[model samples]
Every structure is written in structure tokens, then in C-alpha cells.
Target: MRITLHEVSKGRAGQALPSMSLEFHSGAVRFALAETEQRPTVLGLIASGRMKPDTGRVTIDDTANPKELRRRIALVDAPDVSDPHPDITLAGVVGEELMFAGVGATPLHARRWLTQLGYNELASTPIGNIDPAARVRILCELAVLRDGVDGVVLVAPDRHGGSPDGWWRIAGEFADRGYAMLVIIGGSAAVALERMQEFEAINASGPVQPLVLEAPADADADADAEPADEDAEPELSAAEPAEAAASGPWVAEAVEAPEPDPLEEEAEALREAQGPASSIEASDTDTDTDTTENGAAR
Candidate 1:
């Protein structure tokens, strides 16, 4: 399945945004490295099927009504539209989703699936108590469990301190099942992920261009600020010298690195078990080729 946007534009009469074209395809992973507002708006329009491109159109492979496409297309972590019921348990969330999709699976079935998926410990935990990444994974599974899901669009999934690698692993799992994955991000995270141009889109006109995210004005100013001299220290007033000398020699307090959160550690472990399929090029040697080749061979 594929979702294509041709010169899509939204917003005010003359101020339509993202005037660029985009496409998302099945069994592939793609990202939209855009601004905070731009990513969410475009994601909302695409996922909700309310997006009527002023100059272009969005089409699904075998579907006409975008609203009906909701069953096959899932949206995760989109701003203002992805909050699950906090009072529900993890299993309860799955059960509710199954019901929504008209699947007759019982809550016990949801529990079993969670256990098989290495989330047994969280099965009975309240959705509010679990990590947001876990919730997003559950939501994605909900889409996959439905009869005929084609793809899932994740909007700013990194917003809640969620792991990009974790979602990439989960997307990989679904992609293995022939489902497409669209990951949308903005700001620093978008810049960080801008290098992942391996996945191709159905409607791409040319080569994948590097996403150039500009630093905010204030951030650039801070970056360009001159550094202070190494030996320079602010001078105390002459009148306060005696007081400073009496005050125990200005001992510096040591700051300790914070202990890792157990919840996050468990989430990381779970994500690892799911298998990370994507790697950002942080070092000199290319890890993407290695990971992708290994994954493909498997």
C-alpha cells in the first residue's frame, strides 16, 4: 500500500505550508524532518483523511475514502490525537482496540499477546504507569492486529523521550510483515535523523535530498558566542573580600550523573529484544549498511 501527496498545501489562503510533495510506501520506512507545526499538521491531515490538498491529492493503494482508510492506517503519537485512556490497563487497551477494529479477541487474548511480545510484566500495569513508548507500541500492534493494516504513521514519536531506535525496531518488525512505516520528527531530533535516506518513497521525483535543519536564532547566537578565558574568574568586590575569605574558600559542589530510570531501562531492553533495524551514522564507519545487510539476510 502507498500514500502519496503531490505538492500538498495546507493552512491559510496564501500561507499554505510544506508546499512539497511526499509519499509513504508499504514495507518501507521514511521520515519527514520538518518543523514542530509542520510535521504534526501534515501527519494529522494524512492520518485523519481530512487533508484535501489544494493543489494535489492523497491516495491509498486500494482505498478511496481516507476516513475508511483509518482501519488500515494507524497514527501513533500525533499531537492532540493520540492519548489513550490513562485508567485502562495495558491488556485493556489492546482489548479495546480489538473491539474497535471489530475483532472478537478477548482480553485474555490481549494478555497472551503481550506476554508473547515480552511485555508480560506490563500486562496488568495501568496504561498511565507504563512508558509512552510501550503505549505507542501497543497502539501499533493494535493496527497490525486488525484484519488488513497497510501502514502506520508515527508523529513526533520522540516528543515524550521515546527511543527512535526502539520505534525503528518495531517498525522493522511490521515492515517484515509488509506494512509501511512513516516516522515524522522535527527540531534537533529531525536533524539527528536527517541522514537516514535509505528508504525510498513511491512519489519521489528525484534523489533523496539531505534535510537541512537550521538552528534557531537564539541557539545560533549561543553557539557563536565567544568563550571566556580559561583563567578568568569574576572578581569579588574589594569590600566583600574579607567576607569571601571567611566563607570557607568557595568549595565547588560535585554534581553526580543521575541514575538511570528502571522504566526506561526495561523499555530499552524490550526494544532491543524487538530488534533494532535502523542505525544513525554517528561514527566514521557506516553502520547503516552493516545493519541493513544483516537484517535483509536474516
Candidate 2:
């Protein structure tokens, strides 16, 4: 199945989108490099079936209603919309997704996919326990659990640092398995795109071009638009790495856990040893009696 968007335009906070059009063929992979805000608007419009092009149309294999094609389309790792809860177990996350899509969560089916994706060990682990790269892999595995998935759109694939070619490899895998893949990267993301010769790419992050607005009397009608700052680009220092994301596997920055005080630890241990009986007594007894007992003990 193919998906096509023609002349689609959207506005966020009154800023209009620039001539955005996309086409994803079956068993193919496509990439879109866009500004942070613009990516979500375009992706959300396609996912929710609410996209109405100001001039053209969005169609999936000739079908107009995107809602009807929901079963065959999957949006994985989309910012804000489809993010997996960090606290949920990996299995729980996938199980809920399977149920939502009306698929059975049998051990064989679930395990097979997880293992194939090199994530079986993390199945019982919470999503927060795994690295960002692993989280992306898990979501992709969940997308193909049901049969006949025509397309999968991944937003902000560069959030997790991995092989510069990692996403392209994953997309190629999906394409080989008969699913069209669309990977959206943020304009500010540090990923390198030189290795993506096999995929088609669209650049949507440039300065917004003038378009005939649907409403003429909107804001900024008289004010001159400011020119982009040429000096905004940072000069690289000799010590600073040019491409950090491409240098190695991105391990998240470690947070310094507070050291435990001995007194606090002892007090906590004492409370645990006292167990439910102490808690019950303190809660159930009269306030006056408890105060008197505390004074007598002291």
C-alpha cells in the first residue's frame, strides 16, 4: 500500500507550513528532515485522518479516510502522541498495544518478535530501564505484530544515539518485510544523513516560503519579517567533537544519586522492622493516649 500527501499545509501558533508533500510506496523507506514543531503537525495530521490539504489531497492506496486505514498504519515512537510509559514493563507495553489492535498476546508470537529484534531479555524490564535505542526497537517490533501493516512512521528517530546508519538499517528491514517506512528527523537533531543513499529524503526545515493564506487579514500583515541570523551558527572549538552522536553508542548521562545518611538508614530500617503493628497502633489509638505514651516512653 502507498501513502501520498499533496500540497498539505498547516499552521502552528499562526506560522504557516512550507509546501509539504510526501509519498511512501509499499516496501519502501522515506525520510523527512523538518523543524521540531513542523514534524509533529504533519505526522499528527496523517495519523488522525484530519489532514485536509489547502490545495491537494492525502490518499492511501486511493482510500481517502485515514481512520479506516488505521489498522494497516502504525506510528512508532512519535513524540508526545505514541510515547510508551517509562514505568510500564516492556511486556505490559507490548501486550496493551496488541490488545488495542485486537491481536492475541500469545507467548510464542510475542517472544518471537522480541527475540528477532534482540529485545527478549528486556521483555520483563520496565521501559525506563532500557536505553533509548532499545525503546525504539521495541516499538518497531510492536508495530509488525499484526499482519498486513502497510506503513510505519517513526518520529524523531535521532533522539536515541545509535549507529548513524541504524535507522536506515531498521527501515530497510521493514521494507524487506513488505512494509513502507517513514522516518522523521528533527532539524536540530545531530544525526548524520550522508549514509542514507538508499532512501528518499525530504527537507522541510528551511525558512517558510510565502504562501497565499486562507485568511488574508491575519497577524504580520504589515510588519517586515526578520532575516535569519548568519552568525547564529556556533564555531567549533578544537576540543569539542564535531559529531558526538556519530562517534559512539549514546549512553544517557548519569545522574548522581544522593548518598544515604546512616541515621536515616537506621531509622528507616527500624520502621521496617516494626512493621504494620506500629503503624496500626499509631493510627488506631486515641490521640491523647498516643501522646501520653510517647511522653512516658521518652
Predicted structure with the largest TM-score when compared to the true one: 1
Residues 261-292 of candidate 2: C-alpha lDDT, one tens digit per residue = 99999999998987656345545566535435
> What TM-score does candidate 1 get on C-alpha atoms?
0.57
Q: Assess candidate 1 and give its lDDT.
A: 0.69
**Residue 143 lDDT (model 1):** 67
The residue ranges of model 2 lying beyond 4 angstroms of the native Cα positions read 12-17, 47-55, 106-117, 188-191, 195-298
Q: Candidates' lDDT values, in order?
A: 0.69, 0.67
Instruction: Name the regions of candidate 1 deviating beyond 4 angstroms.
Output: 13-17, 37-42, 47-50, 62-68, 195-298
| Model 1 Cα lDDT, one tens digit per residue, 114-210 | 8877898898888877776676677787767767667888777666676566766666777777888887776676655543333323335676689
Candidate 1 to native Cα RMSD, angstroms: 42.4
